[model samples]
Target: MRGADCASDHELVRAKIKISLKANYKSNKKHRKFNTNKLRDSSITNKYQQTLERHVGNLEQVGKSSIEGIWEIYKNAYMKAGKEILGCKEKADRPWITLDTKTKIKERRAIKTELIKTRNPIKRKEI
Candidate 1:
């Protein structure tokens, strides 16, 4: 395959890895233990478990690459979310600045102000 084709394949694999990581994260959060009820046979269970472990190890490597790719895609997502939640923007420019600081700050401030106004309403006394 050409270099471009190889790169595309790598990107596709990376995307799959990202999807798997997300699914595993959700599954781990939602369920304390993996559901192995389907594998009733001990041999099958052992095999399945081994496969899962190998897949998980591979996923970890992929996850690292995927995270790097994701950060490249939207390096400011965490920063933006933090700014929105914390009511403050980071002073330094993020490695990823697809959106300008001005825009991010403006949006974050607007959201923060809206949240505060909604959550902290003044009580009116009866006349």
Candidate 2:
């Protein structure tokens, strides 16, 4: 099947191919993502520092101040304090989209899709 339609005798040939993609299903649940942006907030940073201090104060009970021992205690205290102050957040597909905004966008997308598929100019400007 010579489907090539070359305007010139030396024209390059091109191939047309069709490909389909399957939708991926990845649940946003289970794993919790931390909000690093919260660190920029002075309130949160202060809270974390205060909490770290409190947690580390109890580290004396863990015993001797070996480098490894101190490091371990500090790390644990930092992580625990961070989690306690900031909490676990599940990052969203669109972080800016609120429930109401999402609904509106979905509705708008449906309208736009219908306008394109049906070639309805009125539907295009309905919003």
Candidate 3:
């Protein structure tokens, strides 16, 4: 695996490209959960609907020449209004695990451990 031979005070060296296949592990992307329940609040819901109506009403052909342009205009206005009126909910990086669920998991693990240690039919049945 020899690189290019170069001799100079300031040398530019070239090396063979190493092609390798690596696992493309996806980052844990939490699904965005919009608080659509905000729509249940009368005031917020009304504001959102009004803002969206205004935005849509104001929308005109963006590119003027292409159908995609007009659609894009509508899409942008819709998204912008939704963002302004019903702002996206901030999500925690990790999903919340309730303390009750945590306690239940701990109990299950302890039971499994006890069943393994004793090899008792009763413990196995309990587990």
Q: Which candidate is the best by lDDT?
A: 2
Candidate 1: tens digits of C-alpha lDDT, residues 1-127? 2223221223232233433344433344421233334457686566655654443444445466776664543434433433333333225665775568668767765654454456444421211
| Ranked candidates, highest TM-score first | 3, 2, 1
lDDT of 3: 0.68
Best by TM-score: 3
Tens-digit per-residue lDDT, 23-110, candidate 2: 9999876655566678889999999889989899965566768889888988879778868987777655856668997778677666
Q: Residue 23's C-alpha lDDT in candidate 3? A: 78
Question: After best superposition, candidate 2 residue 77: deviation in angstroms?
Answer: 0.5
- Give one digit per residue, the lDDT tens place, for model 3 in 1-127: 2222222224365669978998798889655445677889999888887887777664343445488767776776777776787777886686588889888877766655575578667766866
Query: Higher-TM-score candidate among 1 and 2?
Result: 2
lDDT of each: 0.45, 0.73, 0.68
- What are the TM-scores, per candidate, against the unseen true structure? 0.19, 0.41, 0.42
Q: After superposition, which runs of candidate 3 have C-alpha atoms over 4 Å from their true positions?
A: 1-19, 22-33, 59-66, 92-127
How many pairs collide in each candidate, listed in order? 0, 0, 0
State how far residue 98 of model 1 sits from its true place (Å).
66
